[model samples]
Target: MEKRLSHVDDNNTPAMVNVSTKQTTLRTAKARSIIAVNDEILALIENGDIQSKKGPVFHTAIIAGTMGAKKAGDLIPLCHPIGMESCDISIEVIESKIVIYCTCSVTAKTGIEMEALTGASVAALTIYDMCKALSHNIVIEETRLISKTGGKKDYYHE
Candidate 1:
């Protein structure tokens, strides 16, 4: 069968996909966000996290990312509300960029890709918000799904 956008109706109006009949299964997804920082921002990093006037940048981002993942359904109109079984956020500095990875898992009818993506994006934003005082030049380069498994198909990129 030809694939169509799940979030659209016959009239081409936006709609939420109905997952009611779909069988429940374990679903998981991972997403990545990369933020480029200048040397001034990098200098603030110590002991696995950056300390700003607000708090530990990496630690706060982790918490915020998990919350974002849980709230994805409320934030995105088409997304189905999912009670996530687990959410993990990891942050690392490589070269001049801050790399964030968000992994989410759930037992549900739909995949957990959106939650992971939202988590990573929010984590990157939290980092920017915390470090903005030091430099506005901080760049959030990209947020993309790294992998997803469940439902009809599985996907992975590098």
Candidate 2:
């Protein structure tokens, strides 16, 4: 097995990977986040009663997710700054939980998995922020990369 270390030095100092020699490819990644909310909040969403003092919940989250994907490198240390070609965010309410999916693509030397993950996570946080007044029992259950393609190796969730 090969160890994928971020740093080439034994000290493991923080540094960005040099991808100048790597081939540029069309890379895409999809990630998802599940946020579990209380029944009261779910009821509000189902009833379409999102007229809180904070404004619409789902719409705002979608916008925030897109912005977050573009700024992923600024938020995450050691992540290569990437200019995403496109970012799409979608949210679906399932029973008492909300599912957020963010897909990002770029033609570059690096993959966009971090951008996708960041987008979903920020969107989940935005949802929590918007709905916290209704209930504080919200839980960001999980955030994971669903798939990645066009890199040296392709990855998919099993």
Candidate 3:
């Protein structure tokens, strides 16, 4: 069966989903972003974070990720405006890659997968922004939803 798009109306116009009738539940979502860098910059990040003019690299990205989760509705059209209960971001270095995880929680009618994704995406971009001065070889390889709980169903990757 072909899956219907929740954001599309019968008239084929983009529309926000109505979750007013749905019961509020504890919703949580986790997302991940991976960035690959060359050996030169990897060595610079050996201590785990880089100090840039904007501030500490991972520190600034964490703040940006939280902000992104809270403002996902403003950035993505057709998304419901939700007040996130909590948002957490963690950055880790594995070999020559930087791994970022953003988890968002909300007590609302709708799931917060979009918010989590937005957080991860923004965090990755922030890292790229801070590290770009060192090397242009930085690559944001992937951004994906790792898991989501609550709503009608729960999904977990791996």
Q: Candidates ranked by TM-score, best first? A: 1, 3, 2
Question: What would the per-residue lDDT of candidate 2 be over residues 1-158, giving only the tens digit for each residue?
Answer: 67778545556676788888999999999999999998888877644435567878888899999999999999988789988999999999887789999999999999999999999999999999999988899999999999999988999999
List, residue by residue over 1-158, the lDDT tens digit for candidate 3.
68899999889999998888998999999999999988887776646788778789999999998888889999999889998999999999988889999999999999999999999999999989988988889899999999999888999999
lDDT of 3: 0.91
Better candidate number, 2 or 3, judged by TM-score: 3
lDDT, candidate 2, at 17: 83
lDDT string, candidate 1, 99-155, tens digits = 999999999999999999999999999999999988899999999999999878999
List pairs with backbone clashes in candidate 2.
none
lDDT of 3 at 3: 88
- Segments of candidate 1 deviating more than 4 angstroms: none
